[model samples]
Target: MAEGFLTTHVLDTARGIPAQGVKITLYRISGMSHRKIAEAVTNADGRTDAPILPKGTFRPGTYELVFHAGDYLRASGQAGDGVLFLDEVPIRFGMAEDTHYHVPLLLSPFGYSTYRGS
Candidate 1:
């Protein structure tokens, strides 16, 4: 059994390595609104092997993953001005069953992208 229901990873393309200490926030979508779910940080490997959602709290609905790009870049010693163009990265998706949702971010100074992964 999974301890949580959501997961993510972050790769700093500019640095060509896994991004550590990136702040990630999870949210639950409610009709036309959103509710905060949980937050976590990426490990040294740039991955969250455990679920982001609280244990035994899995449900079917839309969710969002907000990545703090600017903060991460700055913390990693990159200049804040114009560095890491994307300030906040938000990824919204849905869950249908008790399954693993791994969202990995491939990021650079001027751009970033993510997708559903195994």
Candidate 2:
């Protein structure tokens, strides 16, 4: 069985490398309201050093992982002012069980995709 935790990773598809220094924010969502639960920045490996939601804090609910893609790309010299096509990318997903949630994002300056990963 998968461990109970929430995690994420980012890849810079345009650069063909892991997206480092990307700011990520985790939010719990309810009807018409979103509450910030945690925030992290990607390390050299394009992943947070620790789980955004650790095992003890894992819960079943609707959550969103917002990636500051524009800032990251700009900082990495992949995008420029007024030229970035994609900015904050929000991946909203539902967690119904106490299992691991690995949401990985493949990103570029103009596009992005995500999937439920192992």
Candidate 3:
């Protein structure tokens, strides 16, 4: 059987560029427990150098991806030093054991969207 993996990317919708240097954290959620599984930072291409959840380590369960957007917004000049409207953005989802998941984020200063991609 083919094992699954998880990956993500960020795009700066307002600036029409790839969001670089964004911090990404992965968590495995079960019942009332949230356990951090992995962490990554987006490179210049708006993607991590490696998969957040590699194929061999994949499992079927609920997961969450936390994108630290406030820092990136400030550094990219999309936001000020003041408190941001959107700080840490969290997307909670479930995955099957045998499907590759590509979660892409289309982000702006005040709004963001995510979808399962190819």
Candidate 4:
């Protein structure tokens, strides 16, 4: 284990702008167990700037990245006052070894997608 870990970015696909003020929550899961690990707010450039996981925090298991899409789209004036297709988007995946996880969100008002990155 190292001293720190993890990072992320958020891109507003519809508006072609950096998604600021988006809430990102990280979770650690193993078997039937889950726990909140960390949280961060995207910066002006749609990135956390600093590391998401602190040093010596690496662990091999499942993880979840929950992005507050609806709130951000509304704040950015890209979405109207209605039920959104993407409210709180949860991305669940597994980590087999100690490595850096760059989970990025490409979000739009109608749809969204995510992928594991370097």
TM of each candidate vs. truth: 0.86, 0.95, 0.96, 0.90
In model 1, what is the error at residue 54, expressed in angstroms? 4.9
Sort by TM-score, top down from the best: 3, 2, 4, 1
Across 1-118, the per-residue lDDT of candidate 3 in tens digits comes to 4479999999999999999999999999999999999999999999999999998889899999999999999998888888899989999999975879999889999999999998
lDDT of 1 by residue, 29-107 (tens): 9898989878888889997656788558888789989998889877777656664557898998888777777788998
Instruction: Score candidate 4 by lDDT.
Output: 0.84
lDDT of 4 by residue, 5-38 (tens): 6788999988898899999988898778879988
Clashes in each model (backbone N, CA, C under 3 Å)? 0, 0, 0, 7
Error of 1 at 26 (Å): 0.2
For each candidate in turn, give its C-alpha RMSD to the true structure in angstroms.
Answer: 2.4, 2.0, 1.1, 1.6
In Å, residue 63's CA in model 2 sits off its true spot by 0.2
Prediction 4 TM-score vs. true: 0.90
Candidate achieving the largest lDDT:
3
